[model samples]
Target: MAIIRDRDLIKDWNDIPIDLIKSCIQEHQKSIPRLDLLENYYMGKHAILSRSMGSDTGLPNNKLIANHAKYITDIAVGYVAGDPVKYDGKQVDEILEVYKQGDIVSHDAELAKDLSIFGVGRELYFTTSNDSPIPKATAIDPRQIFLVVDDTVEYKSLFGVHYYPKRDLSNAVIGYSVNVYTEKYVIKYNVKDLNGQGYDVADRIPHYFDGVPVVEFWNNEEQQGDFEQQISLIDAYNLLMSDRLNDKEQLVDAILMLKGGISIGDDEEEAGRTIRMLKKYKVLELPADGDASWLIKNLNEADVEVLRNAIREDIHQFAMVPNLTDENFAANASGVAMKYKLLGLEQLAKNKERYFVQGLRERLKLFANVLRVKGRAVDVSDVTITMTRNLPANDLETAQMISTLSGSVSTETLITQLSFVDDPAKEMERLNAEKDVDMKRQQKAFGMPINQDVTVDAE
Candidate 1:
């Protein structure tokens, strides 16, 4: 969302002007309000909460919130990234060892959630300063950090800016501290002026990664949040539900209408006492021709329920997320039937995977560069990333499919089909090891040495 194209940054390349950096920061500031709104929506702060019930102000104004935004986002994130992404390639174990040390699984999930919430996510990879330095990645708040890309067709990232306001004891913003991440160096700046036009370089530290250490993960090509398109629908649902409750409350406190003739004591205090006595006794003294009834508005329960169901369905449908609690999902659907039920969500996950995998490749490159310096260079190009959708698997069906395709497909591919197998390559190794042990036992039973080949008699 913070992509700005400047020909000058490309022309100068190495010598980036300070004013240009300030302008990019200012450009990023413009998008903060929209980001803040999306974040607030996810946090259950809907427009209905601030709604004004005008005119008849005495009516019950219940601000009920469903928090469907968070629900949909969590569903998408969990469906895509509930399980850790698997890395496969020649010598990928070394890279995975680094991932294990950095706890990439948790960070990956966090990044996916951020993408769902803000439409874009950012991750910063840096090397630890302690002994035995290893590259570590942490998800950065998209609101506080952004990458500056060039005007070329590729839209290559020129640099990254991570800036935050400096606050004093009273939490008053005095100035700003900005960290500009270039390919070679991380330049720190302190802007003391009210306007961000002027700043002084506080420090410059060299980061020996192959590229700028920040990676941007987009939710989609347009970079819109999962529920962004259906936000209005969500708000409408919240309003309808809240007002429905209010209507029920109004029914409970319906006004009493007395027709014909009714009498009370002459004084106003006596009238109040008579009303209290009527409430306490559940009886009203009236003339012979008097009649009483409650003034309640007719409520069509079926219509309200239908409208509520429509809104709920649209929010899930347009968002491409499924209502997991819906009857379609609860009917014990398995395998292909369950996949059909989740087709929309799977499509959404596919787009997310496309971009998420891109960001991960960039992260892998950064780790590869750092590991290269440590005499453990890896060929990142050979590495393939596998994303498994987090879903309930039908183990019997999967086993049958695997058995049918055993010889037709590669063992690694079959192993990957099994949800229980975390690492297909590792599982293959264990399988081979077991086969070797079985072969050795057969040779010993035939009175042959372990290394010697055993020839079985046809007789």
Candidate 2:
């Protein structure tokens, strides 16, 4: 046997071909001898011993001898026939040493033969526990490594899995060593120290690395006032004037008598000037003024009500006579009609009732002419016809007759008759008396009224 160095043994373990290791174990039945023995020998011991041990004095010598032979054969095959190897502490140390040196460890035949006894591996790599006194080297790729030095900080091992930390790379400063996994880096100074040193820590921080300042800069040297004082004074004056005009009482007074143009007096000229001012500002306007009407029209209902209440109050207190005349009435009606026209009422016009009645009468006359042309007598008794045609009949019978014939009567005659009877009861009494006297005269002349009952002798 040759004495193999630890490094050489590790190299062989790293260099062995995986296929050769498998073939050697299969042919010799030598690899994993202990595992094979465990599988074959003890597996059937219980069944064999159970029957033999039931004898009077326990198992016979022959049966015991046979069991012993089987156990011996298994042990010899496992230990001698199998080319087994032991991977003790020394071998493991050697492998780790090689890893620490950053050298490539390849599998070879010798190490594979040794490991085949236990059926382990052809090649393996090792590392020291993190707390062990092992000199660590930089990973082959530095980008894969994370270096942290803070005592208070903590880290978790992901069981050899790699993870990259998110970072604002654009904001990173030059000459800083960043932990690629943790996204943290050591700073030359803390925030307080940076401020004490008059160095803007914002300049070094990842969030504020860009050189642009956050606050805007103004150049005082080139700036001018540009008459801002005068502008401010004017603004103050306008604000005060607005406040004064906002007073409800002042606004109403300014709208009313402040512009007295219809009176005569030395003060009239001043009043006229005031009126001009009010008109210019549109605080007051002439009657039927388009602009004034527009203002009122645009006002909300509440505001209109407020102004109307104010006007009513003024009229009540001052006892001013409202100038209501035919001209004014006509103007008001025209305004109302104009509003109605705008609201889509096409028939809205001056003297609306007259226009409506005339139109109705024309329709009735056309209906009556149509009935007459069709040879129907004008039955004036139908109230339905009288109402529909706007025909007036003296009585219900006449109204019914008018409806039967679909005829119309003159409205003038009906209206005159309706007015003739000042007292209805007196008119009814006089008419009944006249009717009785006429009936008597007819009875005396013809010996009876038409269709009156009479008796005669047949013989």
Candidate 3:
């Protein structure tokens, strides 16, 4: 949850209330356990691994873990951010150049993954030095940074808190170093004690950006991770599969029962010798009316398989992430059919795009403000952010659609719709240049005027 405060409580950053900051820190501290749990799940440290089998009962209890959380998260992340998010508009090239310098594509991918894993992502935009005024942005761990907004209808972001543990020479965390980002400055504070009960100002550094540099991106309206709701289903699947394997192992090591055939001495050593001899000879001589049979638990393999399939299907279905290995996503499927199969994922992506776009717009605004301070004219309002789903497409089908709408739609529009085209404006410019070259060549060949169409008599 985001930290909220009254806007009028503090006149300025200099008069910031220390108690409120401490409270915010405390509130953030409360969320650490949950965030750590989600991170552990993503890293394959599931709750099942911590379970211990009972030593008293002689049964095979296997703690098998399937990292379905990671699988769902990675699929959602790749589907949304496998292709670099595109930014376009008037004077956006300069902003894009800044992004390129900062390697924003990789940063965006990282942020996307964070959103999938934690349901929230954060980014910080800043300028390095006066000599190099180009703005750079980086993805920040959501657990380390939080935006505090005004407690109003608009909920405008007042500032952001980025805190980390302060370490000495021995690498022991003595306290926390907190950086509070405001509209005009980054106010630094140091909490000397382990708990953030009290703090002292370290320094106040001015920043050129006109607003808070940090931006928060939500995965969905509820800010829930892709696999969060399906975690129970995943756990159930893991348990079922683990027990299935345990049953198989038990079957392989089934107990051999000899009703009345075998006779052994009362001593343990004598019984062991008799058992070894029987095993070595691979035969058992029984008395009359005696029988030998293996005592094994009868497992309903068909029922177990059905339950396994059901749980697996529920995990994927509830996660809203398609099982790529499913036969429904076969290579031979038509593009329309593929899209139908991905409709759930498409809906999920749309919700993600809604929030991710907001974050990108905020990032662009920061860049524009910073560039303006550096004496550059940049209008970031008109910028457009485009997100493409990373799914296989039928080029031939797309080509046919483009051909049919060649004259009806703008060439630039059609060009941008093609998956291969990265820059539609540049592509249009190249097309125009090629047309001019072809026109000049025809004029030289037939000795006709440049603007006139050449005519020839047919024999």
When 1 and 2 are scored with lDDT, the better candidate is 1
Clashing pairs in 1: none
Pairs of colliding residues, candidate 3: none
Q: List runs of model 2 lying over 4 Å from the truth.
A: 1-306, 309-350, 377-459
Native-to-model Cα distance after best TM-score fit, residue 233 in candidate 3, in Å: 0.4
Model 1, span 119-147: residue lDDT tens: 99998888888988888998989889999
User: What is the Å distance of residue 78 in model 2 from its true position?
Assistant: 99
Sort order, lDDT high to low: 1, 3, 2
Which one wins by TM-score: 2 or 3?
3
Top-TM-score structure, candidate number? 1
How does model 1 score by TM-score? 0.95
User: What are the per-residue Cα lDDT tens digits for candidate 2 across 1-459?
Assistant: 001122222233222232332232233333234334332332333223233324574322222212222332232222221321111232233333433354321222222222222222111112235564222222211122212112222221111111123335686433322111111111221122211232222222221111111111111112111111122232233333333333432334332232323432369788688757866886544444233222111224466456544543332222111212325323544445634422321111112222223322322232233234444323322211111111122465544554555435543233224423333345656767898788778878977645556555588
Show model 3 residue runs off by greater than 4 Å: 194-198, 448-459
Q: Please give the lDDT score for candidate 3.
A: 0.85
Residue 105 displacement in candidate 3 (angstroms):
0.8
What is every candidate's alpha-carbon RMSD to the true fold? 2.0, 55.9, 2.8
